[model samples]
Target: MSLIVQKFGGSSLANMQRVFNVARIVTQTYNQGHSVVVVVSAQGDTTDELLSKAYEINEEPSKREMDVLLSSGEQISMALLAMAIEKLGYHVVSLTGRQAGILTNSRYGSARIKSIETERLFKELDAKNIVIVAGFQGWNKYDDITTLGRGGSDTTAVALAASLHADVCEIYTDVDGVFTADPRIVGNPSKLRDISYDEMLELASLGANVLHNRSVEMAKKYGVKLVVRSSLNDSEGTVVKEVGSVEKMYVRGVARDNDIARIAVIGIEDKPGMAFKLFSLLARERISIDVILQSIGRDDTNDISFTVKKADLQKSLGVIRENLGMLNAKEVKYSENYSKVSVVGAGMVNNPGVASMMFEALYDADINIHMITTSEMKISVLVDVEKAERAVNAIHDKFKLGEINS
Candidate 1:
């Protein structure tokens, strides 16, 4: 019998009926005599509601306390799911992240998992019990509850599957599988049958929300098998592994992220270490920058523009402004009206004209491109948020991504 690790997202367990739906999915696997371990996120909107409640009490709650508050969401899910499995006359045990031996660094709301002690997991499995562990939370060295950032449950599940050396890690969500483009934005985008870890990682980091990027990183590191499918259906889902089946396809998917804001630091002295001094300050503040563009030095000055998540825009500005004199920069300009759209594929490594094709599509759509960046597997462009949807559809059709499965 295979040791299967299954994870259900918040949408899959939104209510009583849905909870039972997930229960049956787990029990069916258990009935087949395979050892089962289940991981779950909070019920739908519970995390948001809890956050609202916390903010109502305090505008800026302590990160430590926020971790304590947010981790409760998954606890509710695990217990209810355990009770549902019990109602089905099956043996099940529910454990919180701490009880299940998930250890993480003390970063509070965005803690990084350190290690997972799998003795308890194996002990429970040895007793023939279906183990249900709370996702998105673990305890730090101080014994305080810590949460992984949003969508961290996917990371939790994959980490467990790696530590346990399970046969396969199945991530069940609302959608059938990973698609070439978000079906909501690009009509009838093709769902991919299989994707490489590198391509999936790019799509996830670029804001395709089907799977968390950290989970893909861990899966690749440990060589764990992964499948993403809809919990509500029995269709075969997308498989993520080292290599994709469609080797000749130059592009695999298109993704858009609307949470980014661009910052421009203008007129820095055209000298060595200027870029390093400017970015090192932001790095110390843990503000991640993306899609950076540096202009050629002119008149003894150069300008650098970069993007960061909207949430970090203010903090990033604060750090730069506080140290403006130290970095010898002239002025800081910022905007929140932009979005990033990207295309990812392993086949892009040996491909040419991919960028030109993308730019041509945007040009035809009359969408203005603000900045551009490229890697071996992906290309990203920043554009007005208002035209982001048109940009996505234009590129999707330009590449005929919808016909991927045909």
Candidate 2:
């Protein structure tokens, strides 16, 4: 029998019926003689609701308190799932991140797991019990509850599988698997049979929303096998690993992220170390930056424009204002009406003209591109938010990705 680690997203266990459904899934796996360890996200919209409550209580609540509040969501899911499994006459135990030996850094709301103490987990597995562990959370060195950032549950499951040396890590979500484009947007986008870690990481990082990039990064590091499947059905999902044997497609899929904002620091002194100092201020606030563009001004000044998640716009703006004079910038401006559309595939690395084809599609669709960035596996462009869906569809059609099947 193989030891298996399974992670279910919130959409998979949103209600009691879904809870029972998930329990049956777990038990069925157990009946097949696989030792099962399940990691689950908080119930449907639980984290969002908790954030709303926290913001209602205080505009800027302490991160520590937020972590405590947010971490409770998964605990509820774990306990209910454990009870559901027990109802089916299976021995089960539910453990919090701490009880399961998950130790993390003291980053509170966005802590990175440092190490996992698997003694307790092994004991329960050895006892022939299906173990239910809360995902996206851990205990820090200060012993404070910490929540991994968004999509952290994926990381949790992958980390657990790596730690336990499980046969494979299965991530169950509402969708069947990773697709060429969001099927809802690009009708009948093809589902990928398999994807490589690097390509998947690029897609996830560029906003695929299937698997968290951090989880994929960790999986790549540890060589953990991961499968993305739908809990509602038994169809084969996507297999993510080191390599795929199929002939590589020019573009595997497209991802569009509308949660983007652009910040422009107008007329900053064009001097050495200015970029570093200015960005350092944002770093101090823990803001992540993306797609930096610097333009030469008429004289000893330049303009630096960059993109960040829309949610971080305010904080990033604040940092800019806080350091405007120090960096000798004329003014700071930002726009929240932009979207990031990306095309990802392993084949793209050795291929040329993909960018031109994407541009051609966008040109045909009359979608205007604002900013651009590229890596070996993907190309990302910023465009008007209103045209984001059109851009994605046009690109998907350009590659005829819908015709390619997993």
Each candidate structure's TM-score, on Cα atoms with residue i matched to residue i, is: 0.98, 0.96
Give Cα distance to truth, residue 237, candidate 2, Å.
Answer: 0.7
RMSD of each: 1.1, 1.6
TM-score for candidate 1: 0.98
lDDT value, candidate 2, whole model:
0.92
Q: Which segments of candidate 2 are over 4 A away from where they belong? A: none
Local accuracy of candidate 2 as per-residue lDDT tens digits, 23-121: 999999999999999999999999899999999989999999998999999999999999999999999999999999999999877899999999999
Candidate 1 residue lDDT tens string, 178-237: 999998888969999899998999999999999989999999999999999999999999
Clashes of each: 0, 0
Candidate 1 C-alpha error for residue 292, in Å = 0.9
At residue 375, give the lDDT of candidate 2.
83
